[model samples]
Target chain A: MLTGWGRTSPTAATLCAVHDEADVVDAVGAATPERGILARGLGRSYGDSAQDAGGIVLDMTTMSGFTRDGSTLRAQAGASLDDVLRAIVPEGYFVPVTPGTRFVTVGGATAADIHGKNHHVEGSFGAHVRRMRVVTGTGEVVECAPGSDAFAATVGGMGLTGVITEAQVDLLPIATSRMRVDTERHADLDALMAAMTQGDHQYRYSVAWVDSLSPAGRGVLTRGDHASLADLPAGTDDPLAYDPRPRLGAPPWMPSGALNRASTRAFNEAWFRRAPRERRGEITSIPAFFHPLDGVRHWNRVYGPRGFLQYQFVVPDDASALVGLALQRLREAGAPSFLTVLKRFGPGHDAPLSFPMQGWTLAADIPARIPALRDVLDALDGEVIAAGGRHYLAKDSRMSAQTLSAGYPQLARWRAMRDALDPRGVFASDQARRLGLTLGSAP
Target chain B: MINAVGQAQSVLVLGGGSEIAGAILRALPAARLQRVVLAGRRSSVMEERAAELRGRGIADVETVDFDARDTASHGAIIDAAFDAGDIDIVLLAFGVLGDQEALESDPAAAVDLVTANYVGAVSVGLHVARRLRQQGHGRLVVLSSVAGDRARRANYIYGSSKAGLDAFAQGLGDALAGSGASVLVVRPGFVRTTMTQGMSEAPFATDADAVAAIVVAALAKGRETVYAPAVLRPVMAAIKALPRGVFRRLPG
Candidate 1:
């Protein structure tokens, strides 16, 4: 049995820990006809994309190691972004793209085609892949580079086409591990959106944490760029130091309803108040600047046994107002979303099922213990779909098949390619089955 | 799988026709429970239940034969269930609440009740616990009763059997403390199920749905033990403190 990061929608599968390409192929070959298979990274997908109920799940975390060559790096499917960063940061290099956390594996980033705060400038993780090795449904190992059918299908393919064995990625050059950050507080969503739209181009990374509990959609906005050697104070000897450790961990057990509306609102208010009205060029470590939440282990447990859901969606730039509308709906519904993350996406890649596009994306984490959590999210999904926005598949756990189909118009094409690669549907997952990605339509 | 909101995608009810288990599954948010497996000795009844769930839009509904008396095959049955896919909850609801008078007269009947309710539950509970531990997560729901809280003269045999089951379940839960798996012991006083249809309604008697509601809520809270009709907690407390002579004077 396996579950995604959201800790919801658990499914049972025959978990096989694969140490290398050979093990993955053997596990794939051993899959029964009645049950399909899927590969799992660090189980950070937030949903069921990496799990196949009653099927086979290749635990690829053990199949990890990496080799770097100047600006290019080759890594196993399970090599985490954190692992690569630790190996390369001291050498004055960084991964081309990283999501909110560095705990995600290289293969997962490739499969999800993940994007980071710098997406407005650097594009998604897929854009930096030089080539990759994949174990196909037929148990054949093949190397695919960008522009190839296999490459396109495997990228953002959600692990349906084959088991990603390894990949070569292009790295970004950086002079220091520190990020020169700028922070500002906004009283309304409109002001924050305007600020980001007009000035975000000046920085490499930009994101806003909206106060969803507030009626005005108030927020704290931050923009950052990789610090150069000159940006560091004279006393700083190692600007490239990259050490990340959890400061604390939520206890395993907690009473349900621990994070109610009152507590969440108080937290949001305090967090917003702590941020400076305007600060610039403040040097912060890489983890502090980009993956602050990563410093706390098992933080999801704070939501109690019900855990929490990450509802993320992206709409075209013109429909940016939908973000505020969605936030207002959550506020009106008293959903008590603990956090609201807002980001801008540049042009999306060619992966048919890739989540992002040239748009505005907002992600909210709502504790599932809320009685109306599901209803509120369903309502938000309708509003998002109506606004021509789509939910991020990587973060979705409860969206209906129809909503998924409506969001990703190219799903049919992606399914066609998946079918062509695995005619027997040997590579499938709960998410795939739920959305009917391999079954033609919603089941 | 258990979801972020205490919703499970799949459930396996060992006692497929158990109204309490059925109600528990039904009370859960329909969108969260996509699959259900009703495993019991009665295939036709399980199939009927599965059909009803299927009609309600549950994606997958299956039936498997599970006889509590078949203790030797418990491991295989558990393995088959997990093989079917990750079962989020294993509901141990099978038990024979034999007639106290009949069991008093027939030693064989008394032994049968003990075997099915206590010995059999222990065997299967251990099997399910092993599988859940191997999976590194899941829930084992044992249907105990307030009778287990004390062996009463009205139903001492049944009460004793449940008492044994309850103790064993709690111990198993403790053994699994850090394994990401846990056990839930549900003690419903007098549930109005088909099993207890002809019995007089006891004080604070509740229906299967009511007990099911409490069980769902308790599971969400990650509770180790719960007494249905909640009022029973205070009532049971007072009863447990009564003198032996006074307790014996209570009617069946």
Candidate 2:
């Protein structure tokens, strides 16, 4: 399997097309006598974290079954976030802490312990998870819940914990389908951070979009929160049930040249300007707010013939300066990203490789062909490490194994848990090997 | 951006189901080859080849739709493979051997042969070359032939096609200088494969396995050019060193 987007081109490979859950279980059963079994979700992960380079890859996203318990939802590993959101949101409950897209699976979310715009208020999804079912390397099926070592080990464990066949996620109680968002514009970087810190507290949910293409020292920040039921105006009351007008996709295999620097820069300007200037109290749906980007099926194709590399880094609150510094370096290096998002992270949960903490996380997507791109990112990795921060494993495509080890100090403990559960090293992945997240060689 | 440093990597065989490509992949270090991809016209064959590679310790095997004659999509095809993961190397071994009599009878068929053997490869080579340049490192191993050194009426159609390929590969190697990437040109005379099922063989002709060994060795050294059977090198040198009249009279 080639890299997702963010690179200039695709790589080739020989692969197994596992169509269903039985394929996953069988693949797990056939692994070489060692290691734990971590299931693979969609290949959206930039790095090899989701890929089993030389091991059995249990592609369980194909599993089809779902049972809802009031606000608590239980779906198979193959069930996608979009599937859950669509199935449950209309019933008056919403999944907590969705990432940028909804194509990700429930199993993937637990494995990566994904977080989102509401992270500052709700923490990560791992925190809301009630329980998980995993298949061990020895072919034993086990169950775990929050506070259990297995629970902590499984969530954000990057699939190293076990193959999450099904997960119980705590959904939020919703008043309506639309979110009454109040987006405020920030003239500068400091103003943006100021808006995020103060405004996030007032709203149950929050997110911001920055003009990453802005001059090194200047940028725009758009902040928002969930709309209150009272915010609805003269329109009919049931905005939740109102299906959004869908847009058609590009015909077929569109060229990468469509998403050039000029177009992206222009889009950024319009998005920053038209962010409902002054929080006009517009009624927006859940998909628009949570998974605004999910509309474009293979949006990565926009990057063109050159795929892109996504770099997401979190710097502990102590090193806020590094955020601005890193952007400046990008400008100076002429390596600007097409999209950059900034979010506030609450206290991190238990996953060793999970990417969250009480700090600011900024994510950017850049085409892979840019000269010196790797060097610039490598240097940035050092800065984040110096600040006691680390990179997000899900969005990482090029981090070295050494960097992974150095960034995640608790890796040994995680490894110990993984080994205890899967001594022979049954569960393995290309991402784990590439970044040294798995048990390496013999040791 | 991929740091292949200590991790096992992947290799792509452009010609799916090519006996030669399969042979080469089998001989490479199993630990280093995490995955293998066979790109060709029929996915069925690509699948068969992928299985073969996977059996040789390449647990990750894949097949992509690729048509040599359809050169328009070469860039996307090669780039797509690299994007899947880090394609450590790309082995371009897709080619055809048309009958000299058919080529002599029909110029149209000869042109198709020319496009398949040279034009299609040139397009893919250039497209893959740009990617290799961008990734900062990769390998491009193309299969050429001794016939390319000097064209003869005996097989001018195939000889000229190789002539074009050989030149292109050499130039690509030079273009990649200092880019941390290079092209390895393989000039193997005759290999008993589907392409030459009924060919007449001369002395020093080797099989796919023998060609695989020489090509792999040549690659490990980052050599500019190589000849199968080792003796072919000296033999070709002496041939090129011969008088023009004598060279043309010799069997191609």
Best by DockQ: 1
**What lDDT does the true structure give each of the candidates?**
0.85, 0.72
Residue A49 alpha-carbon offset, candidate 2, angstroms: 2.0
lDDT of each residue in A1-443, candidate 1, tens digit only:
46788776555677788988988888877765455788999888887788776677888899889999989989999999888888899989999898889999999999999999989998889999999999888788989999888898889889988999999999989999999999999999899999999998999999999998989889999999999899999989788888988899888998768888889989999999999999989999999988898988987778766667888999999898898888887787777876799999899988888888999999998776676776778778888898888998788777877788899888888877777677656887877766666765211
lDDT string, candidate 2, A347-409, tens digits:
888666677889999888776555456567778888888888888887776676657777788
Please name the candidate that would achieve the greatest lDDT relative to the true structure.
1
Off by over 4 Å in 2: A5-25, A33-38, A216-222, A234-237, A242-246, A251-258, A440-443, B1-252
For candidate 2, what TM-score does chain B get against the true chain B? 0.92
Residue A94 CA error for candidate 1 (Å)?
Answer: 2.8
Query: Candidate 1 — what's its lDDT?
Result: 0.85
Give the chain B TM-score for each candidate. 0.97, 0.92
Indicate the worst ten consecutive residues by lDDT in candidate 1 chain A.
Answer: A434-443
Task: Give a tens-digit lDDT track for model 1, residues B89-118.
Answer: 889999888889989999999999999999
